[model samples]
Target: MQELHDAPLAPLTTFRLGGPATRLVTATTDAEVVEAVRAADESGTPLLVIGGGSNLVIGDRGFEGTALRIATTGFHLDGTRLELAAGENWSDAVARSVEAGLAGIECLAGIPGSAGATPIQNVGAYGQEVCDTITEVVAYDRTTGETVTLTAAECAFRYRNSTFKDQPDRYVVLRVRFALEDAGGLSAPIKYPETARALGVEAGDRVPAARARETVLRLRAGKGMVLDPADHDTWSAGSFFHNPILSDEAYAAFLARVRDRLGAGTAPPAYPAGEGRTKTSAAWLIDKAGFTKGYGTGPARISTKHTLALTNRGQATTEDLLALAREVVAGVHAAFGVTLVNEPVTVGVSI
Candidate 1:
């Protein structure tokens, strides 16, 4: 275990914008992690658990508590079953699955963050979500102070949310287990239309596992979802807003508002979220609401490559980023009667 006092946190996040923590502890093993957490708890200190720092927005004022960074590494594969430590880099793990000829997780290839964070957010991309393959999650329950394993259903996985997210302080993820498919070294049937078109295959067609991973990586790079330090557009938490899923009545009102703002001929992209629910594109909403790609002129702005991403262009404060985010949310709500919600977890800040 490594410990630092008054540690700067900006470098830990993809956006590179937060302030500092009163104390930061980097744990290389599950034991160290639990010990550190217990110590903080015994002292009655606020605790913040960070994995990849991909989905976080810390305030300029910093955290006045213990920030425990899980840095342990473990990757064990038994046939089609895979277990990863909380600290394993998620994107790299996806690539490894492809190399091992596993079918699941191939579509989640370029997402940045740690494996532990995936279950917390039920991370999904290209029509594949972690919840689809996750069999169990082993976590240290702070409430009971014991290591407990929760099955997928018990996690209560929903669109980009789970029990871990609902009770953020109650559990610290230690490891994640997934059951992937062999599929004769072929990828799972392509579900996302964009990936199908990019691969020159129809939806539901199976391609080489490696090819599918590479195709998703290419698509992600184009949208600045893949990290590239030289590019300001990639300096963002992949997608800033969650695609709003509205009830039947809400969707009807939103559609009416869309027609009023855009025109009778215009239609906002919509997809079935669940029974009586419709999921509309956040990117489309931002663009139609008059916030085009690369929307802001400030240090914080919309990513030039993707409308869904809010970025920090070299020099930006947490406040600057939040300001742009608030602007987009307010404008979209005013124009289309749909309020956008941020996907990243915020500390000492609200938008």
Candidate 2:
């Protein structure tokens, strides 16, 4: 275990805009992780867990408590069953799965984060979500002070949210387990129309896992979802806003609003989110609301490659980033009557 006091946290996040923690503990093993958490809990100190820091927005004021960084490493594959420790880099794991001829996670390639954080958000992309393949999650239950395994269903996944996210402080994910498919070296059937179009295949057609992974990585890179420290566009928490899933009634009203604002011929991107729910595109909303790509004139701005991503173009403070976020949210809501919710978790701040 490595420990530091008054540690700067900006470098830990993709946004690169946070302040510092009162103390920072980097745990290299599950035992170290548990020990750090237990000590903090017993001492009645507030605790913040840091995984990949891909989907976080810390306040400028800094955290007044302990920040434990899970750095444990383990990646074991037994046939199609895979287990990843809390610290294993997610994108690398996806690449390994594709190299191993696995199909389930191919579409999720290029998503940046730790494997343990995957279950927390039920991370999804290009039509494949972690929930689709996750069989179970092993976490250290902070409430009971014991490690426990929770089945996928018990995780209560619902589009970018899960029990871990709902009860953020109650569980420290130790490992994530997934059951992938061999698929004879072919990828799972293509589900996203954009991906299918890009691959020149019809939806439901399968391509080589490597090809699928590569294509998704390319697509993500185009949208600034892939991490690249040199690119200001990539300096973001991937997509900053979650696609709003509205009830049928709300969708109808929103559709009317779109038509009224953009003319009768105009339409917003929509998809069935579940029974009586419709998921609309956050990118579309932001664009139609007149916040084009590369929007903003400050250290923090909309990504040049993607409007859905609010970025730090270097020298940005958390407040600057949040200021841009609030502007986008308010502008989109005013234009479309749909409020945009941030996809990343915020600490000591609300948007």
Task: For residues 98-137, write the lDDT of model 1, one tens digit per residue.
Answer: 9999998999998998999999999999979999999999
Clashing pairs in 1: none
Q: Give candidates' CA RMSD values in order.
A: 0.6, 0.7
Please give me the total number of clashing residue pairs in predicted model 2. Answer: 0
Q: State the displacement of the C-alpha of residue 29, model 2, in Å, after optimal TM-score superposition.
A: 0.6
Candidate 1 residue spans exceeding 4 A from truth: none
**Residues 162-247 of candidate 2: C-alpha lDDT, one tens digit per residue:** 99989998999999999999999999999999999999999999999999999999999999889998998998999899999999
Give the per-residue Cα lDDT of candidate 1 at 310. Answer: 95
